[model samples]
Target: MNVEDAPEGVEEPQILPLDAWHRARGGRMVPFAGYLMPVQYEGIMAEHLWTRESAGLFDVSHMGQLVFTHDGDIATVVRALESVLPGDVAGLGDGRMRYSLLLNEEGGILDDLMVTRRGSEIYMVVNGATKYDDIGHLLDALPDDVTMNLQDEQALLAVQGPKAVDALARLVPGVEALVFMTAGAFDWNGHALWISRSGYTGEDGFEVSIPAEAAAAFADALCAEPEVKPIGLGARDSLRLEAGLPLYGHDLDPETTPVMADLGFALSKRRREAADFAGAQRILAEREAGPAVKRVGLLVTGRQPVREGASVVAEDGAVIGRVTSGGFAPTLGAAIAMAYVPAELAAPGSGVRLVQRGKVHEATVAAMPFVPHRYVRASASPQTPSKAGA
Candidate 1:
């Protein structure tokens, strides 16, 4: 399909380069992140479980990749970025990445994204559904000298799970030297690519940004690794939940501030001290006094899982909030959900109930990362103190 250059009004929802390949492998296509992606290859439940035990490949080409460069001053351009984002961009070094949020005037989260400093340039990846508006916001708020380029030629693939590290190490030797949130360029079969030791699954994995034309071929190569299987959005969602990672539209939005979402840590010590980012006033205020409601993980007692938009209630039956993201955690072998409830009820072991289909299932507030993280990070040394880059 000649969709890369298709006119705005004439195009259907974009398809990743691996669309046909996924279909050939029994993938069940579904619309997600504004792209027609595979929701399941073999089956949702089986795929979800496989990713927990072995590596799974995901075509995330629908995500928005943006490149930014400074014309005269890099720091000056970064400060402009800080003006709208709650991240210490000025402190990020080359080859490092940080998680951050785009905040509104009231400190509400507009979107959550990743920012990486690649040599003199910066790269950003935002949720596909929010990419259009996110780019417009950055263009309007950032310094005039800062140029933003949508990387329309790039396609992103995520390989995640326990075996991810070993699978990638075969192609990109010494990647084990990289830490979480760090990335570098590598060459595979004559194809140049950017690989980041980052993923939403909380597993030891890499997100490879490849040229649109090379995405499918590289994915096929990785699949050649005996442990690697083609995963779909269905498994991706479940894996992230098992990791307790938040989903943008479900766990966060323009209505929920960072502090409210339990993501105040994204606003680093420097950004907090500098106090210059957008909605800094409101965000800091919430951090000081505590948010009225807080996001917390829920562990259901029953086998059936409660999903997004399910009402949360007090033990006495008073509706307090709603479940944001949830599913049966294959790794945990239990039903888990993330929800927001009154701050007083946010603590671990606090009793709460998930009301689904008119039946209230007993659950409780709990610490997240319902499953353990197996992230591979850089080792520390005297010269590389705290080598696990921020």
Candidate 2:
């Protein structure tokens, strides 16, 4: 969901394995995260709606896929990872994944990532823009016995929506057995694939990591399903925004802490009690006293969307906070945004005044995921689906 233009004097944007495939489907190419990727094909609105109702395929090969191994036992690698990340790495069951934050010594967030315990090796997926820095950080923090492998020859694809499982299960055969936050290795056309029942979109989904050479064929096979259609980055952004998922460079940064970003769930209870991991002291202290600013969702009163960089202002026009992500949520049929505001004003239904381009807009602090999440968790009751954040 993080899209940006290449700055002046930057190197040429690289192409994904499916670059030609996207163009063949009329995908509009654009620069994002140092890569030439599709922003849209048919259209953002139609693609978004289709995804919510049926299935949408997204090309997310730009994300960094990493595998960590150790000469000794897996515990050695887990300890090394737990030292830098604020998650209980050792407690993760096999094939289970956890969302975590990479924090600086001063408690600022470097990035948010997903870590999965896969067999003897640990697998991780990081934001593309910060993957290199993350690799460097891990190498520096890890002991010499632990080895990190950057999976450069892999392509990541996500199939998301209510019917994603129906479409994906037909190809992979056993992927439907994977519950949320679980992954497994499977064979497709003789190519090994690591498939996870997880995705950026709030809907039930699967992310498939396949060999680069086989990516195009795999994509074609998925799209061949009547319930599936290829989606672009434009719809990806709006879907995540509606789901209340934070974008790294925009909603999170080096200056933002987990508590300030409303991501305390990333800080495991055991890790918090043990006070191990980077910035534990500061993070735990903030958890006790509360952060000065808290991230909250906003429901704009009008149809026009308020974009990022809009200022949250007081009645007297003094800037109080800033909007990180904003857009018109097609599912909710309303303009929504995520912003950091004073702790006292973080409660739901709190009045907020935003100014964009010198025009004042009225909004109210609201609960996140303007649209409800529909994850198929193992523990979800049949009467009510899970509303858990992705």
Candidate 3:
């Protein structure tokens, strides 16, 4: 199931901290986001299901982790961030995190990210492919008082699935207290790490940011657990797809706004009321009057998986939209896809047609998250020993 990198002529991809570990474990390394990442292990199907039933460790070191500081105060920096981001940075409580988007001047999405409030410093994790662009934009958009620190020496690992807590608890105790969307600073093997109970799999999970040198050992520790297995990018994509979460370059881009992408929830209530963020005028207007087109889920009829760039047509064969992401959902055992189409035709059960590679297939508009989200709420009891303490 290993995926290899670029052909002979292309330059070799940059190696991550766990490159050796991945190679030793039969990972299929492929070029992604300027790095060589494991695309699959045993197979995409097995890895995807393993994550749903148990825990899967993923090396996401390619992502960019940033820390923001302000000389005046954290509040000042938070306000400055609000100028470009749509989330209420000032309202974020200690150790709490929120999913947000960086919007362009025209209300289009530049990138999607996870913002966590950590005492004096605000932490952010942006997509690897757009991290540089995002950093450049922030450098120009933020006020002089705010300082952005890019943490390139850190490696990220996601332990995700229903058994994630149990598997992770074996190594780090006291983390069970952290509920969904919450983060905390913890120690593992004498090394400090920031862990958040959030992930893209629509399941209970934790993402840990550790120093690059210690990443391999930390990943090995997590993988040693009986419930944990190393997963790859292939499963990662399928999992997010099943969760109906949009990928940046694919489902979302600079040309799509939050309203158009069906991500209005990311725009905090106060932010919407104030309408003070980037492209507020256009976003707020779209919220009230509605967007012309909307991102929607599609249930592809038959076995073929409709892929990106496929034309979405109306009943009369008029091109109305295009597919952005599509693939076979292991959990659902059916082919599913995402596309942007007219608002009127975005409703569930609406009839549509997908033309891919000259093959036209019938499809039906479906509600997102082809699978139900199983995020663990705060009510779950925390009980596990801390291996690090031992």
Question: Best-fitting candidate, measured by TM-score?
Answer: 2
lDDT of 3 by residue, 1-390 (tens): 011121233345678999999989999999998789999989999999999999999999888888888763788878888888999888899998888999999999999998889998799999988887888788788887788888878899999988999989889998888888889999998999999988888877899999999998988888889999999999999998888999999999999999999999889999999888889999999999999999999999987899999999877889999999999999999999999999999899998889998889999999987887777657653332111100
Which segments of candidate 3 are over 4 A away from where they belong?
1-12, 379-390
For model 1, how does the per-residue alpha-carbon lDDT over 146-253 read when each residue is reduced to its tens digit? 777888788899988778878988987877677788999888888888989888877777899988898887888889999899999988888888777888899999
Put the candidates in TM-score order, highest first.
Answer: 2, 3, 1
For each candidate, how many residue pairs have backbone atoms clashing (under 3 Å)?
A: 1, 0, 2
Computed on alpha carbons, the lDDT of every model, listed in order, comes to: 0.82, 0.90, 0.87
Residue pairs that clash (backbone atoms under 3 angstroms), model 3: 2-28, 3-28
* TM-score, prediction 3: 0.94
Runs of candidate 2 exceeding 4 Å displacement: 1-10, 381-390
Off by over 4 Å in 1: 1-11, 380-390
User: Candidate 3's error at 11, in angstroms?
Assistant: 8.6
Candidate 2 lands at a TM-score of 0.96
Error of 1 at 17 (Å): 1.5
Better of 1 and 3 by TM-score: 3
C-alpha lDDT of candidate 2 relative to the true structure: 0.90
